[model samples]
Target: MALSGELWADLSAERRIFCSVLLFSWTVYLWEAFLAHRQRRVYRTTTHVPQELGQIMDSETFEKSRLYQLDKSTFSFWSGLYSEVEGTMILLCGGIPFLWKLSGQISGHAGFGQEYEIVQSLVFLLLATLFSALTGLPWSLYNTFVIEEKHGFNQQTLGFFFKDAIKKFVVTQCILLPVTSLLLYIIKIGGDYFFIYAWLFTLVVSLVLVTIYADYIAPLFDKFIPLPEGELKQQIETMAKSIDFPLTKVYVVEGSKRSSHSNAYFYGFFKNKRIVLFDTLLEDYSSLNKEQTEGEDGENEETKSKTKNKKQGCKNEEVLAVLGHELGHWKLGHTVKNIIISQVLSFCLTVLSRRFEFQADAFAKELGKAKDLYSALIKLNKDNLGFPVSDWIFSMWHYSHPPLLERLQALKDAKQE
Candidate 1:
């Protein structure tokens, strides 16, 4: 008892806080790992497709999806473990304070005194982000080149990939450094209610980012071409008009330059709203229709090894259906509501209840998009090779939206009604 009391007395508050944080982080990781293990077990053991999935997923596709998900789960496990260990080691070894001291030294060499605390903080932030990016690069490369390439999803050459990565890093620093400097300056200068000023500054910055992201920032990374004069464009315009949506223009982004995955989204505020569609989402424009990579003059490895996968993208009506669902979010104010909710609440995971999703689906149904949306959902699920089977706990905890099967059934039910 005497030795125990001595040991307790010897533990500093800072040490206790650090140990507590580390313990909390590991606990969260272990919980997530347990949930993931359950889901991976489903992926591994469910060799045959469930009866409900039979209508949408063929045996080959089912097996492929299962294998793909299993591989991803395994990769996630190892990567997550590595991250936890890295964080632990950093904390244990005083990596943060060491980096801060190093940043101070660097800033001092640059002729910035301790009085220039903001400059020192900026240096520290840059060094921390640089370190994080460097450490995570190998994992990113493996996921992109190994896992995605093996799955016939990766679309970039090594040169293209590296160039893209460098561009991303540069752009991130450009945005992060300025915003962070301004934010710190605000916090430092605001006399009593610094927290309020900081919050307002962040809110304004977020809104500005959202407004400019698609038009300016995104186009820096991906090519955005106008969705040309055609039936699809006509229908999209008509649909927007019907909902009184003040849509300015539609642009198709060249997403296939990086991956075979397909998506669509809208951005901007009030009267200046624009929708951006992935080129991979339009049937006529999908590059997945062509042979996947360069220099496959003859029957190459992918051609020889695998059967031609199902063609990606949706038909004109299906595309409209998908857009209807997205526009539903706008019309129902779900997007704005989500932003407000996220601003107020700090969730460890971004999992929200599926009420908003179901509401959006129902809104689409009200727009007479039920049949088309149902088929579109199936096509998308197949195109992305999303594993249908999920452990309930994992799905409930992790998924922001309801499952594909659930959405399909809801659409079907709506159609019947």
Candidate 2:
């Protein structure tokens, strides 16, 4: 009877509810992937580029970008399906809860009494994490080696990849083990106010992590080379001052070491905020700016003059305009707003999250950067997540930023107020 009871308890109706939720979530994910594909299809079918966004890319590069988007969406759909299925199978087979129970057993063997809820919680979290990582390792490998390489973006050697994987695992465990344990411990000790205090704890941790990430954590992955004194730096500063945006020096991260993807972003709070541009972004900028071969063997005065005089295809004004858009996020307090919404109203994330993209674009335009920003976007078009996709349904759930067309239209219609 005891054995039967144990089996019966294991197969309780609650498990069914949990499995159902898992399946539903996966189905939603697959549907989102389908919508991404649909968006790509629509983009392919549409020939006419709107005047506002026409300069984003030339016809040829735009076609290549569309194909790339299609490829990515196709891969994501299949991989997403496999992942969902794997998760569902694990749930249906009682793997996660079994793992949880085993974690408790192991913790007990270590003399962490079962009564110690914190130890049990921490053990379960770690074991569960390890299990998931092991299961997902193959897919991660395939993604980096096959899919990304096929797209000409995989730059890490096998040695670097393994080292990175190890570092990430160690760093994540170090951080999450303590944070998650504390949250769970709070639940045990706080009683009725557990959730309220947990919420507050999350907010503080989020803010702290944001402030320190560029300093403490990011150095593990890439080098942050300081941008030297030049027109680019000077213009960026000028633009910041013109808008009363407190300025700091900019950095150029060695982004091309891992992927050809490009980006620029801001970090720090208030006066300490820093702008970071990607090496790939500067690759475009190099066409307009003189290249300095300071440490090169073939350097001569004539070569230096030629490198300096070489016409970098991008303009300084346009680059500053891009910086202006990034600055808009800080000015509008979008980052803080996002943190609050995510911690408090996570359910409303889909709706409330994407507006800030538009707001920042508008802010950039308001800073008298409209035309130059347009020019910059044109140069950086293929480097972004843009494609011609008619993806209304796909966008409903997954889009955390406005579509390129929408962004371009917003910029066109924006005015200083």
Candidates in order: C-alpha RMSD to true structure: 3.6, 6.4
Q: Ten residues in a row with the worst lDDT in model 2?
A: 299-308
Q: What is the lDDT of candidate 1?
A: 0.86
Could you tell me the lDDT of residue 304 within candidate 2?
18
lDDT tens per residue, model 2, 296-380: 5432221212222223234667777778888888788887777767865543676666787777878888888887776667667
For candidate 1, give the lDDT of residue 234.
Answer: 97
lDDT of 1 at 108: 100
Candidate 1: regions farther than 4 A off: 1-10, 291-309, 346-353
Error of 2 at 14 (Å): 2.4
Q: Pick the candidate with the highest TM-score.
A: 1
* Steric clashes per prediction: 0, 5
TM-score of 2: 0.83
Worst 10 residues of 1 by lDDT: 298-307
Error of 2 at 372 (Å): 1.5
